[model samples]
Target: MNLNELLTDAVAGAINTLYGMRPSLDIIQLQKTRKDFEGNITLVTFPLLRISKKSPEETGANIGGYLKENTGIVSGFNCVKGFLNLIVSDAYYINFINNSFGNNFYGFKPPDTGAEKIMVEYSSPNTNKPLHLGHIRNNLLGNSLCRILEANGKHVIKTNIVNDRGIHICKSMLAWQKWGNGQTPESSGKKGDHLVGDFYVKFDLEYKKQISELVAGGMQEEAAGREAPIMKEAQEMLRKWESRDSQVLELWEMMNQWVYSGFDVTYKRLGVGFDKIYYESDTYIIGRDTVLEGLKKGVFYQRPDSSVWVDLTKDGLDEKILLRSDGTSVYMTQDIGTAQIRQTDFSPDKMVYVVGNEQNYHFKVLALILDKLGYSWAKGLYHMSYGMVELPEGKMKSREGTVVDADDLMDDMIDTAKAMADELGKLEGLTGLEKEDTYRIIGLGALKYFILKVDPVKNMVFDPRESIDFNGNTGPFIQYTYARIRSVLRKASDAGIMFGEKIPERINIGNKEKSILAILYDFPSVVAEAGNNFSPALIANYIYDLVKEYNQFYHDFSIIKESDGNLRNFRLMLSDMVGTVIKNGMGLLGIEVPERM
Candidate 1:
């Protein structure tokens, strides 16, 4: 049994024997004691002081004495003010690790409690531009959360809603039409997506100029509407492209293909991919008829201009627009349609939208509208909202061109890691190809860890320099710890030491190894908690602490240098188990771990 369980039993026994009515102590948590405290578990006894009608000291002393008399787990108990601190025996720590040594450390075997299938939608990027750091954050959270859910034994379907057709894409088409000297990605020596993205930027610049000239030429801005010269040209291009204007359609298809291809590269590099992809071009109208039906059912109202909207004032928000008067679906309408389609396609117990916190209001309205529309499953839908990733300077602004490009940021990280590896003389044995792969793994590992280590709901600063440090609370540090264990395992293997057989031995209740075992025993709880809360940071923190403990053990204990063969084999097994836990834990976080530093 783990230390927490042992302590829980001890505490409950003490409470039952002292209070005489078997007062329940099942809900009591035996959390790790802070460094300043002498005990490993602290129990606040204030609630019981009044019930017992005794002084705080007397109550604590009574419980403490009871625990000491009844259970071997407690070495001693100290009454510190109103809290009862329980010091556990070193033997319990050793027993905990040895018991969990061969089992799944971080693997989550969720109870077979008949959970409903889940749908997670994330990384809905527009085709007109390359993905930026914001998209990276969204993808990571979505992908990692999907893994977390799946690890919890829930059937999870990951989907991406691609924003492929819109005014933004229309600009790209217009710009390509007007500026085309028939230049291709190959001819321009540019990434296909970036090549298309260049035209997108060009369209915005030119469209702004056109708008300015029209205003200067006495065109009424409001009266001009979406039918102005520049706007009309873009709309015409979209119409023609939709109607299969051979040349226009061909260019559209070609440009979209380039963007998709580029997106695939980025997704593969980042170790993220979706199970299914839904495009706005195809599914935009799925919700349109549904909303219209809602209108007939009096679930939504049509404004005088025929614009469709839902009144959300009852939910403490403004009315949300569903569709324009022109019958084109707005963002909300598209989302509603997407959700309906997913219900039909996967029939999940829940649908999770892993979007940013900026759209907190949007998702609130989404869930409300869905529920009002009479989908019973809507109540189970969740918005896995994550905070923005700001640079040291400030928030990343896409319109102002202050955004960090995903490809560029990843490349920069890999290059930085490679440079550090070279400077540390760690690149001597690695070939060019090995170095390239290592750089990718280590670099992406650092980036993913930095993002995942923080609570998803809290806004965090991404300092690229600080995130790559080898000795701090970073990905590299955990990876290095894993690598060290791996090296020891390899040496044992080379020395003809086989660790396959169980040593049939008890755990060593020594200094740091005992602490290390205690942490390892918490693996099941960590996985369950993280998966249940939809937070990968919990697992990240757990792994980081595990590594820290291992590091201390490595410095203080001798595993390979010990003279006793059985002890060496036992320690090797411990090291092997730690390595397994680290690898599995990191994998769940969507982070890669290198076998070597």
Candidate 2:
């Protein structure tokens, strides 16, 4: 057990002995002692006063006296007001460091065989465009969440649902058919997604021009938009594709394949992958059938125009459409189908949709509809809603071709990393290939860290320059500290010093060493908290605080240069543990630390 657990049981025992009443574990409130106080663990005596029948101070003094006299765990005690602060002996900390210093996976728990399986769905991108900064945040949050959950010994399946069909996709297909004289990704030398994305933009431009002409001819804006020739063509294309028209189906398959190829490159660069991928084309038909079943079962109602919908008004939401009058499925219908298909395939304990906050209502309705459809597992569906990420310039617009493409943004980050590293001369003595590889790691690390460090629910303005800086709570700062620790250990190894053995049983550990051990002891809890809350920001900030503390301890004392062999080895072991925790923590955030940055 850790120090807190040991103290909790001791306090419980003391309460039972002193008050002649057994106190529950919850009543024994233990917290870290205040910074100004000279103790490691503080117990609030107010709760025990009910059983002690004494004043607060008297109760605290009685508990403190009992702990000190009865247990080897508390060597000294001080009562501050109604709080009893217990100071542990140096031997406890020395033993803690010795036990934990050699553990490589110090804070990680092995997967529990009986744990429930969780499926995390993220990066549900449309085939119409390449992923952008918004998609980057979505992918990173999903990927990091998987790592955190796995660290907490949970079984997590990373999944994606590609919005590869619908009217939006038809716009791009129509544009390619009209303007492109049989051009291909091979001929244009552009990523398939980017090429397809260009056509999406082209469709918008032409659609707008047609709208303007119709409006000039004295038609209402909405009427002109519906009547636009290109819009009509795209709508017809969607119908043809849905009917499995051979020509349209061939074109759709070819374009989608190209986009998938491009998407693979981006996913690889971002260091994320999916165990399974679902497509709208495959799921929409299932959704249509599910909707018809819901209608027959009276779970949903059909309008006079023959469109199907669910009345969520009783549940504080307006009615949501399931199928259009033309018998085409809406996004909600596709989602319902996807949920059913996934549950059948995985039988997961929970289905988490790592979507943006904008879709909060969508998931809410989805869960309600699933429950209404008689699926008992509907309650297990959760929406991991996250806030949007924007550049300093403003929000991005895909149809206007104004968004930061994911591939381009990664390239820019790498270029910025190279420039900054060269300016700092941190890349000296590295080969051309090493410099290239290091730049990629540092660049991607900075991007992922800066984004993941923020609360997922809060909107963030991503500044590439600020993210790559080597100082102050940034990824590079933490990475640089890790690299510094690694350098020290390497030099110690070169000097024929080894830290594989434990520290001596009677070694003296100063306050700095004790403080580092305390933080290390809290690593597992920090990871568990992050997993429970689905927030990587918890892990991100925890590592930063640990790194900051280690840097201070490094400046205040010597490690390998210490005169005493035991003290020197202890410091080296402490440094090694910090480095291991740093690596593990960064790995949870899907960021890598270099040994020599």
Candidate 3:
């Protein structure tokens, strides 16, 4: 049992003996003692005042006295005002250290023998351009959440919905057809996504010029944009692609393949992947057919322009369109279809979408619409809405070619990691190849930790240099602490000194050691809380605090170099277990911890 549970049980027995009444577990509230106080856990005597029929101090003193003398875990107690702070025995911590030592899955629990799977959807990138900084945050959050969920003993399925169709994609295709002398990824020597993205930017440039020309000819800028020939052609291309016109289909297939190849490379480098991927081209048809089904059942209304929509005014939402007048599907249509397909495939207990906060209403309407169509699973749908992530300079616009491409961002991080590592002489003993691999690990760890440390609902600016720092609650700092512990262990092993998980008969310790044990004991709760809240930031920050505490303990005491053999062995065991938990915690955040920096 944890500290709180153990104290509650002891206090309950004491309450019945003193007041002739046993309190419910709900009435027995306990929290970590305030730092200014001298105890590990504190109980408020105010709640038990009615039964005790006495003043707060008297009630607290009575219970504290009973527990200190009657229980093995309650070493002592201090009553201040109404608060009863109980100092837990050192043996409890020592026992925890011994029991937890050498256990690889110490803080992790296995999934139930038979549990329903939770389906999480993230990294829903468009094929119109390469994945950008926004997409990077999406992928990292999704992947890390999946790991966290698994660590919390849940069966998780990681899925993606690739937005590979529609008007934006046609713009890229049309731009390439107009401006290129038949340039391909091979001929241009550019990554496929970058090549395609260039055409997307090219389309914007020319389309703007057309808008300007029309404005000069006495047309409003908005009207000019609508009347632009390039925009018209792109719209027509979308219709043809939807109808599967032979030539348009061929072109779409070729370009999308190029983009997919490029996306795979980026995903691999970013260390994120999906077990199952749904495509808009496939799901949009299913969505359109489902809309027609809804229309037939009077669940939706058809517009005079031959469009499809659902009026949610009664549900406190505005009308939402499913299909346009031209019989083409919008993003919502395909999303509906994707939801249905996944429901059939996984039959998950819950479905979560990791999208930006901008789409908060979109998801709300989606669930409502699904429920309107009489699907019982609609209630299980959730939107894990998050705020935007921007660099220090400012926001990014994808159409204007100003977005930071995922590939480019990762390359910058790795390169910056190399420069900093070299400057600090961190890779002194490693071979050339090992150094390269370590650079990648450090770079990506920095990127992931920087993004994951912030609360999901907050919009924040990401600074590359700030993230890769070797100190101040950063990834490298925690990693270096782990490496330091490993160095100490390695030296002990080399000198033929051994440390085992067995508890020593008598070993000297201090408050610092007890404090470290307290931190270690929090791992299971932290993991569970992170999973419950769908926030990997919880795990990231917890690991940082653990590293910080371990560092303080390292500096204040002697481990391998201590003269006392029992003390030395005990400290070694503690250091090793902390390192193990550090690795396990970092693993849940989808980060790597190196033995040496």
Cα lDDT tens digits, model 1, 1-597, are 556666677667776778764556744556676667777778777767545678878888998888878787777888878777877776666555455566753466664568758889999999998998888888888888888887788888899999887777878877877896788888988777787888988887776777777778787776445446777888777667556588876777888888998899999998888889998777777888999999999999999999999998987889888988877778888889988888888888888889999999888898999999999988978999899899898988756888889999899889888988888877578788988888888888888888898999998898777876656888888988998998888888898777745554353445466566667767777887998898999999999999988988888888888777766776787788889889888988898888787
- lDDT per residue (tens digit) for residues 28-49 in model 2: 8999888798888899988888
Q: Which is the leading candidate under lDDT?
A: 2
Worst 10 residues of 3 by lDDT: 501-510
lDDT of 1: 0.81
lDDT ranking, best first: 2, 3, 1
lDDT of each: 0.81, 0.90, 0.89
What are the root-mean-square deviations of the candidates from the true structure over C-alphas? 2.7, 1.8, 1.6
Between prediction 1 and prediction 3, the one with superior TM-score is: 3
Instruction: Please report the candidate that would top TM-score against the real structure.
Output: 3
Off by over 4 Å in 2: 53-55, 399-402
- Screening candidate 1 with a backbone cut-off below 3 angstroms (N, C-alpha, C), the clashing residue pairs are none
RMSD of 3: 1.6
Better of 1 and 2 by TM-score: 2
Off by over 4 Å in 1: 1-6, 24-29, 104-106, 110-113, 215-228, 239-249, 500-508
